[model samples]
Target: MVCESNSTQAAARQLGINPKLLDRGQQAQVVAEVGSEELALDPEIRALYAANKWLAQEFDVLKTALVFFGQLTR
Candidate 1:
C-alpha cells in the first residue's frame, strides 16, 4: 500500500506509522535484492566449470576411439 501511495509521508500518516521506519524498510529491501543477485553468481560459475570438465573428458574418450579405429583400418 505504501508503494502505491502518492507520497511516503501521506502513506505513513494513513497507516498511522512513522515515515522514517518506512524509508528504512525500503532501503533494507534494496540491499537484500543486491545481496541476493551477487550470491546467485556463485552457483552459475560452478555449473559452467562442471560442464567444462565433462566436455574435456568426452573429448579424450573420442580421441582414443579414433586412434583405435585408425590402427585397425591400416
Candidate 2:
C-alpha cells in the first residue's frame, strides 16, 4: 500500500483532528475522492482509470484469497 506521510499533518491543520485520527480519516477521504473522481471522469478517460483501478483491485483480491486459502489448507 502507498503511504502518504504528509496526510496526517495536512489533515490536522485542515480538520483540527489529532494526527493519528487525522491519518486514518485522511486515508478514507482519499479513497472516497478517488472513487468520486472515477465516477465523474469523462468516458474517454474513464477507460484508462477503470483499467488501472481494476488491476489494483484484482491484485488485492487475489492476494487476500491466496492468504485465506493458505490458512485453510494449513
Q: Report lDDT per candidate.
A: 0.66, 0.65
Expressed as tens digits, the lDDT of each residue in 1-74 for candidate 2 is: 33556865786778777677765664566447467644534455556656888999999888889888895342
lDDT of 1 at 20: 79
Cα-based lDDT at residue 32, candidate 1: 63
Candidate 1: pairs in clash: none
Error of 1 at 61 (Å): 0.3
Task: Name the candidate that leads on lDDT.
Answer: 1
lDDT of 2 at 71: 55
Measured against the true structure, the TM-scores of the candidates, in listed sequence, are 0.40, 0.35
Query: What RMSD value applies to candidate 1?
Result: 16.7
Poorly placed runs, candidate 2 (over 4 Å): 1-42, 71-74
Separately for all candidates shown, the number of backbone clashes (residues 3 or more apart, or on different chains) is 0, 0
lDDT, candidate 2, residue 73? 46
